[model samples]
Target: MATHSSVAHANLTVRQTLLHQLFGDHHGWLFERLRARLGCPSDAADMASETFVQVVALDDPHSIREPRALLTTIAKRLMYASWRRRDLERAYLDALANEPEQFAPSAEQQVMAVEALIEIDRLLDGLSSRARAAFLYSQLDGMTYADIARELGVSAPRVHQYVVQGLRACFEART
Candidate 1:
């Protein structure tokens, strides 16, 4: 019987071989497709590489019947995530720009803030737009339920429900 180490090595070898084949076959096509959409060669290269990295993490890379389609799906997700992160950073910077310089956070604090925002965004990803808005308004702005309801054009009770949903999402994300 194969030793456990040897079995693990075999699995690793299989994953590497599968990744090599997929990369060799799809990297160029994926790069060009991303480049055309993004209008940047470097970004396309990075996205393509990230797409392959996602594929490598799959439990059954050999089971893929539509390689290009899978690659496209993965790359699109990576692109969207990259865009979201950029948007978050831009919004954070815009908010910071409005603050007094004396009260400004350090560069490291800014980075940590952005990262926390991203985490919160991810935690709230399952929420509806209105629900997310309600949660942010309550948590970040300390808005009352009635005020959130007015802002969201919903009843105060409905706003309460949204806040509850958002809280559940955050709780679920933690576990």
Candidate 2:
């Protein structure tokens, strides 16, 4: 008399069991490998746990033939994300420090702004450097295509194309 919810719960339990076993078997090895490369034990451990989380989200984690390779790839991506977030935070704090005291954003607003900037960075990730620059100039600085072209040393048409491409990238990312 198992309901559909019960069946789904059972299936999820099985998947969790398999993932837990995998973690139990290789977590130490993965942690040590990350530690050696990153030179920080705590960071390595965090990445290793995040790696397992990523794998568990995969549609077919059991199908991986080279678990270590898969683990390494996931952990590396997590490490990169951590680095990006830290670098972005540092830049944001520096900018805040330089702002006029009366015009400064509140602490909560600063946190929200940093988070928004991080998301914007993620949304723009696949663009060429120039395209990203063009988009940022147009959107953030309210620059015209002609002005962006002059600044970037490109043709106005080229700048427009970059802006269009960047818009498309953002649209695709959103949908």
- Model 2: which ten-residue window has the lowest total lDDT? 60-69
lDDT of 2 by residue, 17-122 (tens): 8888888988999999999989999888888878888888899776878888888788888888888988999998998789899999988998999899888888
lDDT of 1 by residue, 1-175 (tens): 8999999999889878878888898899999999999999999988988888888888889899999999999998888988999999999999999999999999999999999999999899888999999999999999999999999899999999999999999888789
Write down the RMSD of all candidates, one decimal each.
Answer: 1.7, 2.7
Pick the lDDT winner.
Answer: 1
> In every candidate, how many clashes are there?
0, 0
Model 2 spans > 4 angstroms off: 1-14
Per-model C-alpha lDDT, please? 0.92, 0.89
Model 1 spans > 4 angstroms off? 1-12
